[model samples]
Target: MKAVVLERFGGPEELRPADVARPEPGPGQVRVAVRAAGVNPFDGKVRSGAMEAVFPTPLPAILGLEVAGVVDAVGADVTGVAVGDPVFGFADTGSYAEHALATTVARKPEGLSWEHAVTLPVAGETADRVLGLLDVRPGETLLVHGAAGAVGSIAVQVAVAAGVRVIGTAGPGNQEHVAALGATPTTYGEGLVERVRALAPEGVDAVFDVAGKGALPDSITLRGGTDRIVTIADNTAHELGVVFAAGPQQRSAERLAELADLAAQGTLRTTVAATFPLVEAAEAHRLSDSGHARGKVVLTV
Candidate 1:
C-alpha cells in the first residue's frame, strides 16, 4: 500500500510518501480500499507533535483520522457490514494511504460522493457531540464561532434543523455563506459581542467555540457565564471554566448512518475547500495547519 508516513513528528515535511505494508483488520474491524481521506486540524497537531500528551503517536506512523472507501475485507466478529460495501467513518489505522482499517463506519449512501462522504465522520460527530453537551433546545439562540468552518457549518445546519436559532461568526467574506447555512451571520473580532447581541436580543443560550482565536471571553460575556460553553480549539478552556471537547465519545456507526442519511437527503452539507493527491499529504497538512481554509481539505487516493 502507498501511504504517507510520518518519519518524525515535526512539520509537514516529515510526512513522506512511501510504499508501506497494507494494514489488516483486527477483530471487529474492516480494511478499506480508500477512495478519499479527510484532512483535519487534529492530523496537523499529530504531525507536529503538539498532541503527544493527549494522543501519543509512535514515530513512522501513518497519520489520518477519517476515510471514505470500499470494504475489501472484514475481520472476525463484525456483523451487518460486509466486504464490497462502500463505507466512510473514523479510521482505526491511518487513512492517508491506498488502504486503511476502520472500526467505526456506516454504509455510504449511493447519492453521496466519496469526497463528501469522507467529510462527515469527524465534523458530524464533533458537532453532534458538542450540541448534546450544550443541551441546546429549540427557540433558544446558540452562538457558533467559526460558523463557516467545517465543523461549525455543520453545527449551524444541525442546530437550525432542530429549530434552534443560530448566530454564527465568520470573516466578512463568509458572512453570507454562514447565513446561507441558516444562521444569523456576524463577523468575529472587534464588535463581535455587540453584533451577536444585536442578532439575538434575547441573549445567547450557549456558545460553541470552533475558532480558538480568543472568542471565549466574549462568549462568556454574551452568555452571562461559563455555563454551556464548549470549545474544541481553545486550549484556555480549562482556565475559563469551559468544557474542552477533545477526542471522540459519541461516535458510532449508527450515528454516522444518520448523518449520512441527512447528507444524502441534502439536509446536511460540507464545503470541500481543496483536494490533493495522496502524495501531496504534506501540502494538505500545510493548508489544514494554516487554519484559514474555509472548508474541509481532502486527499483523493
Candidate 2:
C-alpha cells in the first residue's frame, strides 16, 4: 500500500510517501480501500508532536483520523457491515494511505461523494459532542468561534436547525458566509465580546470555541463564567478551567449514520476547501496548519 509515513514528528516535511505493508483489520474492525481521507488540524498537531502528551503516536506512524472508502475485508466479530460496503468513519490505523483499518464506521449514503463523506466523521462528532455537553436547548443563544471553518460551520447549522440562536465568529472575509449558515456573524478579535453581546443581548448561553486563538477570556465574559464553555482546539483550556473536549468518547457508528443521513438529505452542508493526492500529504498538512482554510482539506487516493 502506498501511504505517507511520518518518519519523525517535526514538520509537514516529515511526512513522506512510501510503499508500506497494507494494514489488516483486527477483531471488530474492517479494512478499507480508501477513496478519500480528511485532513484535520489534529493530524497537524500529531505530525508536529504537539499532541504527544495526549495522543502519543509511535515513530514512523501513518497520520490520518477519518476516511471514506469501500470495505475490502472484515475482521472477526464484525457485523452488519460487510466487504464491498461503502463507508466512512474513524480510521483505526491511519487513513493517509490506499488502505486503512476502521473499527467504527457508518454506511455512506449513495447521494454523498467520498470527499464529502470523509469530512463528516470528525467534524460531525465533535460538533455534536460539544453541543450535547453544553446542554444547549432550543431558543437558547449559542456563540461559536471560527464558525466559517469546517467544524464550526457544521456546529452552527446543527444548532440553528435545533432552534438555537447562533452567533458565529469568523474573519471579515467569512462574516457573510457564516450568516448564510444561519448564524449572526461577527469577526473574531478585539471587540468580539461587544459584538457578540450586541447580537445576543440576553448574553450567550454557551460558548463553542473552535478557533482556539485565545478567545476563552472573551467567552468567559460573554457566558458570565466558564460553565458550558468547551474548546476543542485550545491548549490553555485546563489552565483557564475550561473544558477541553477531546478523545473518542462521543464517536459512534449511530451518530455518524445520522450525520451522513443529514448530509445526504442536504440539511447538513460540507465544504472541501482543497484536494491533494496521497503523495502530497505534506502539502495538505501545510494548508490545514495555516488555519486559514475555509473548509475541510481532503486527500484523494
For residue 256, what is the lDDT in candidate 1? 92
lDDT of 1 by residue, 1-301 (tens): 8999998889899999999898888999999999999999888888889889888888889988899999999999999899999999999889999999999999999999999998888899898999999999999989999998888999999999999999998888898899899998988998888888788888999999998989999999998899999999998899989999997667789989998898888888778879999999999989988877887999999
Scanning candidate 1 in windows of ten residues, the lowest lDDT window is 247-256
Q: How many clashes in each structure?
A: 0, 0
All candidates: TM-score: 0.97, 0.97
RMSD of each candidate?
Answer: 1.1, 1.1
Clashing residue pairs for model 2: none
Estimate every model's Cα lDDT from 0 to 1: 0.91, 0.91
